[model samples]
Target: MAKEGDGADSIVAATITDDAPTKAISSQGMESINATATAMTKAKNAIVVVEEACTSSKKPEEPKNPKTQVLIVPLRWMSLGMTRAKQQLVLLLAMRLRTVKTQMMTSKLQEVKAEADEKLKSISGENVLLQINCKALKNENAKLFKGYDDLEAKYTSMKALVKEKIKAAKSQAEAFKIELEATKGTNAESISKVAELLKSPPGFFKKQVKEYTTMVSTHILLVAKYLYPRIELEAIGEGYADGTSEEQALKLINDINGVATSIFNESLDL
Candidate 1:
């Protein structure tokens, strides 16, 4: 029984020994698991650090401006050149307009000057016409006065002749009365009667002959006076008158009528 009890105690001790080695092996396994866990955590922390470094390394980019996209922008000097070109064109057109306006003014002034010159010339022509008319009248007056003197001389000579003739006739008046008395006493044979009648003077014979001759002279003088003036007027018209334009023709007709009336009045006194 002691040997059995010792064997039992040894078995228990061996089991405890085996159990201690298992427990030690189990603890080593736990330590290996812990170490693996620590390694995995380090690796995870290193990956997180690298990811953070990569995120930190990237910087936010500045926004691009749409205005900055042009490869070449126009310079201020180029725009100034364009403006200058436009201004030059405007100045050129303005100068042309001014030149045209100046020409128009000059042309208008020339037209006015020409019209004034023409009017002046016409007025001068009218003055010349007046001077010529005065000269013509002056010439006609001299001719008319000369004609009047000649007519007066002729009238005086004719009057003297008539007076001499009347004086001579008065001397024969008694003889004529005697002859008429002789004719009344004749014994009337047909041939003797005829002879007496033929020899006798008619009562009004001398005075009637004188009156007929005087009437012829007066009528001839009147015709001459009017003919002289009419010929003078016709000569003047043919040589110097303007054409038979309406205005001038009317004026001429009126002037001629007035002159004729004046001549008639003067002739009445003559």
Candidate 2:
């Protein structure tokens, strides 16, 4: 009985030693699980703090207003009033320009009328002067025609007188020729008788010859006095009508007088 009791005590001692080691190992594993749970809780707290900082830093949105819609009505009315005022100002300016243009055109018309009146007055004065000049020219022409008629009448009378004088001179020349022929036929007795008669009536033939010469000279002087002036006047008038100068007309008159004087002297000599 004493051996059996000693073996039971040893077996019980070994079983208690094994149960103590297993309980210590289970306690260390439970400590590691508690540390991991604490770290997970700290990470969840830091993520929540970051989300709150970002949200607080963002700009806020603008709020909508009901008064903005009401203000738009007054602004539209003001714009329409400004447009009507501009149109009124433009119309007034156009009317003023038209009035100014009309005034300028009227002034120009008046000036033209005044100038036309002055021109008409000048033309009337010139017409009057021309009429006066024409009247004077007509009077001068009438006088010249009267003078020409008188000259022509005088020339006709002179021609008739000259014809009568020439006929008388021819009769006298024939008589003288017959007396000369008769005297040529007379002899010495007839010549002595004629000499005795001439001595008794002294200067009878001389007086007759002197009277005939005086008559012929008077006739020739009368013809020259009347005809020479008429010839000069006619020549001067013709030169004037032909647009000759006064100096040229006078020169022509002198030439005609010289030619007439030479002709008259030649006729007298003959």
Candidate 3:
């Protein structure tokens, strides 16, 4: 009996001493905490009633009638009281365990949410940086395209200018070639006439000296304009009056030969 009383007292003391809630009211809600606290209070009261009964049973009683000498505690009543107190204690412990588990779950959920939010923020910052880089690259690409177009336009214009210069040079060369052919024809004709005059007999040349000088003067004016400027045209009339027409005619033929030879050589070089 003493041992059972001591066990009951220890259980009640433990129940009373360990009455702190495992979960906070913020996590479990005020209503849930209040209900849990009320249940713990009722369980504690039941344990206190059981402890009081056990303590009273250990006290010394007065010696009266022989039947009343033995302490008459209803076995069923004590058993029911102890059983209900134990059941309440078990229910309270289960409630506290459940509350502690819920609080732990809530705290872990908040931690996971915080980590997820941080990752999302980091990803968003990276995306913004990528967008900025992409925009700069696009602008750079556009500038390169514009510069390429400008260079291409300049290249086309320069090509056309070069073609125009080549065409004008070809046209000028053709005109010069036509003029050189005309001059070659005139020079050949004048050389053929001088050769015919040289073939004549010396007596016939002396007879035709005045006429030959006149022909030579006309040939100089027509074919060799550069040589014409060096000769004195008035000398032909004065030489005929001075009786030196043959000498003047022979000198004119030599000068015409020299001019024709130089013109033919220059044409061959061209």
Top lDDT hit: 3
Those runs of model 1 whose alpha carbons end farther than 4 Å from true positions after fitting are: 1-102, 122-126, 175-270
Give candidate 1's whole-model lDDT: 0.51
TM-score of each: 0.27, 0.36, 0.39
Instruction: Flag regions of model 2 displaced more than 4 Å.
Output: 1-88, 185-189, 192-270
| Candidate of highest TM-score | 3
Clashing pairs in 3: none
lDDT at 247, model 3: 47
lDDT for residue 22 in candidate 1, whole number 0-100 = 40
lDDT of 1 by residue, 1-270 (tens): 112223323422433444333433345445643453344333433323322322342422332433221211222212333333322222222234345456767999999999999999999999999999999999999999999999999999999999999988987897888886776433335447866764575757656655654564455456666778555544543655556665565455455656555655554556
Across 1-270, the per-residue lDDT of candidate 2 in tens digits comes to 112223323323433344343343344444543443343233443223322322333322222333222111221222333333222222222233334445657888889989999999999999999999999999999999999999999999999999999999999999999996675534445547966765666487867655655665455556766877655544433536667775575556545666655655665676
Ranking by lDDT: 3, 2, 1
| Runs off by more than 4 Å, candidate 3 | 1-82, 185-270
lDDT of 3 by residue, 1-270 (tens): 112434444544444454352331244345553564455444433333333434464533343334322222322233334543333333344446456556767999999999999999999999999999999999999999999999999999999999999999999999999986666455456768977877776976766775655565565455644656676556654655546565465556556688765655554464
